[model samples]
Target: MSDRKRGSHRRVSTSPWKYVVATWFAGVLAAVGLGAVSPAGAALRSSLGLSTGELAWATSSITAVSAVLGIPAGWWIRRLGAHRALSWGLFVMSVATVAGATAGSWGMLLGSRIAEGVGYLLVFVAGPVVLTRVTRGGIRSAALALWGTCVPMGLAITAAAGGVLASRWTWNRWLALTALGPLIMAGVLTAVLPRLPRAPVQHPYRAVGAWKGALRLGAAYGSLSLVGVAVVMVLPLFLTERREVTPTAAGTLVALVCLGSAVGGLAASWLLRRGLALSSLVPLGALMPVACLPAFSAEFPLAVSGGAATLVLLVDGLLISAVFAAVPAAVSRAEDVDVANGILNQLGSVGMLMGPPVFGVAIAAAGWGAVAAATFVFGGLGTVLLLPGARTSGTGTAHGVARSLDAQDRVDVGEESEPLRKALDVSRPNRNRI
Candidate 1:
């Protein structure tokens, strides 16, 4: 290599992690954009003269795009390449949020939100696949696990920071403030993330059968989201009413619960590095909500109920993070990663949409106890759906995860293709500096 080329390689290799950090922050910013209107919703409704229905539409319009167009978004990201897709997604969100800030009518706000949703969809699907491409082995898995925390961390930022600030500012200022996150992230990403080459993907696409396990994992993710969102949506209200706490105190508690969830997610990185099978962790984490859901929802004492709620979030976070960390491994071809995430994002969007309504209906009809039953059914279903991945070594499809990070021997991809063992032939850190 020429001296110039070698020096360039050295610079790229020295801080490749910056790209990962910037890309991950873009995901968090996308989430912040989604939840921005939520904190200042009352101001928006009052200022724009929006009815409850209109406000609801404004909030959901973005997620609706995610529900309907996840696969398309995934393919879109694939075509654009992860770096371009991420940059564009962040750009879209920044623009849409600015438009939303100026929107005087419900229709205008709704339109902006829809645009934001498209951007949000792209970010969610592209994130995991981008991490897959950028990092190697342990770095890749760990980054993906941390990616699972984006939603909670973003929500936490909005709820803790956005919520407090909204009370002091007009809704337009709040919207303007929210717009800054994505805009800054977009700039950072462009500078930090060099144009890394994509792996050679087969044209006219062979290996169709190999990606089924990823798709199945996505399905299981949908099932898990159905129950997980329900619990998350209701927990604060549950605390407020059942424990006789103030709404602010309840929100604080909910934030603390999410912190616990983040801990669980971060722990997965450590566990995965140690060769723990991801398959075992998924169901084990899911099962806690089954028991804790009912316990919390029942007419238990405040301490018991609070403890159960905390347990549910922590364990479910572990489960969700495991699934995300397993996502790259779930596929055979490196090219399939985005599409698999798209399916997962799509189904997960559907579940997120249904959760609030489902929990509301259950609560109205059968009281608080219905969510427990719902958890039992959906959590069980999620477990069963994940079984295809679990057939190896009594562990789930995460067979490829925690494999030899030392690069001695790549786990044989063909040994078991059901949940997948991964073909670790993607770009390695040592192979090319950039």
Candidate 2:
């Protein structure tokens, strides 16, 4: 191997706190761009003469690409390294977003959105893997757990900001303005983030067992995601249509629900710090929606219903963070994190694609009660799928692995060399951990 390739795996010897924060911020920017389309959807349609169907396509373009190419994207991250992949992703997002701003036709905007999807995939797949590599023990758990909030947090922020921007500016202009965030973030990441080590360039699909495990985990996580997202997406409409709430009031309630989710992610980090088992948390999270959603659909006071929805969101958030924390804990080798995350992202895309529409259909067929029943069924299925993987030895304890890595001074970033690989083998928990 060339010197560059050999040294590519070596990370900076210092603590990774700063880089973790930096990378997280970059991921947030990408997420914001991912979400910007929703709040601006109306403006986009008016400005570009897009039909509702075309607008839906524009918004979903990102998830479609992710579902199709998630595994390959993970392999790309492994080959290119997280830092480089993220930088490139940010650049692509920035360029695509800017191009979207200048689009005169719906087709042009949709094309830009498709490109942005690929960029979004790269950043999401690589960001957590890099974060786990840089931090150790409690810190790693805390960081990854907190990372789970990026989507909700980003969506909430962009939805609010995009609404304000859409009122004052054309959708294209608003899009152009949003593009600057990723552009600046890309530059900052290129300058500040340390180079990550590249994994051996191999086809991820060849590892049948690993792929199976990853897909199972993905199904669990995806199911949970589907329910959570579906509820959040429809909450406003449900309140307005079913309860006669004002649009402004419904929007505020939805915002509160999203906020609760963000807080729940932080709470999960606290639980991990206190050494709660992920297996237990996963089941609890699944059960929350089953219980909360039906109660939320009951004829309670508006305030009471809103509170119930917020609680459901909180539990959903907690579940998401716990599942993410389990990722590093479940994988036996550090190198596997990227592929594992890839499978997770791909399935996550599937959930995102299915959730809103499925819930919408149920609501149309019956009512909010039907939506509640659907959430319960999906939530239960997710719990069943996750329980087996959650039972893996050491899957509940991130700090234990962190301690092992710290003891060997192997917490720094790099692809696993033979010596380091052997060290990890010796230090790893029971082989049954995965």
Candidate 3:
């Protein structure tokens, strides 16, 4: 038992933050590689004279298909460990990306995107799981923020780099670079990642029972990421379409959100050290909607409005990063770290999958301003939902007290189930004394 405890402690290290960074950057590379290989699908479609439906399918498959791959990827990582799985996944992904860059037909490009989807799921799922298993507290929060910010940050960098290279070089040059990032990432990850000692699979995923809570978390994450998606996708259009800003300038403005997000990551890591409750993130989450208000009411000069938007956007970015940082801790406070992490990630995946569509429909029915308002409404509702349950005696305490009560209740959650163990142990703060 003592040996097992030592092994478990070893599994959950305070070091190995580098491995966390590498694995997450690998996820970022996957996102960048996919984007680089097929950045201008609409233009490519018009050049090919493809139908609207075909173009939509091609454009949507990148993330939608990737989202569906998360479940199996999670299970696979538990069995194979992160290194071997990520190495092979990244290799295959790189190959597919290069293939897409070379494709002469839309069908081939679509196939490559679909293949990349598989690789994306494998890498993204494994990276976070590895981070949680390997770190605790501030390091863990920092690691997660690093991983979370990388997607937007990578996309911004890749998109800009692709545009700059495309002015003089072919698109394939940028795609090649993007593809190369993952291959290099795989090697770096393998070298730096500590060997994950094999352990018996003890915990299994359970269905989330708290729909009220799940919906709140989902809506909050989804709304924020949705606005982010809309901004990333449509900001350039907004600048060029409505404001007559130069494409380069517009692109720069759009990319600033990602820069803000990266900065926000550092803020979140700092917040963790301040000993803030995870639920406090709800207010930050609420700020996302408020941030959008300025974009609508820009009565000042372009520079002024843009700068104002950017500053508000910094807070928006901070909120998004903070929430992502906080949710895992919230789950840790509420349940088992691994199990709650899995469920939270699964819900995040679901939210991410759902976000784009919600924004798309709102964009069609109303407009960008309306979509922003919708984002605000969703976020507000989410904040309200995260408020601690009023009658909740079984929530928000340390792991041991919940365990005792669960044992008394005869739930028989079993020793192997880490989530059950954790959930039972974390007692409600309301009733927990000493």
Best model per lDDT = 2
RMSD for each of the candidates: 6.6, 6.7, 7.4
Q: Which stretches of candidate 2 lie over 4 Å from their true place?
A: 1-14, 202-205, 290-298, 393-434
Order the numbered candidates by TM-score, best leading. 2, 1, 3
Compared with the true structure, all predictions reach lDDT values of: 0.71, 0.75, 0.57
**Each model's TM-score?**
0.84, 0.86, 0.76
> Least lDDT summed over 10 consecutive residues: which range in candidate 3?
423-432
RMSD of 1: 6.6
Q: For residues 344-363, could you state the per-residue lDDT of candidate 3 as single tens digits?
A: 34555565556666766776
The residue-by-residue lDDT of candidate 1 on 1-434, one tens digit each, is 57556645554445535656777788878878877887788898888898888888898788799899998777777677777788888889999999999998888899999999988988898888767765665566677777877776677677788768999999999999899889888888776665544433455354657667777777777777777667777887777777677887777777766665667777776676566666667657555646565445546776676667767766666666767777765665456677888888998888778878887887889887787777777776776766665443234233344342213123232433211112223233344443
Candidate order (lDDT): 2, 1, 3
RMSD of 2: 6.7
Ten contiguous residues minimizing lDDT sum, candidate 1: 417-426
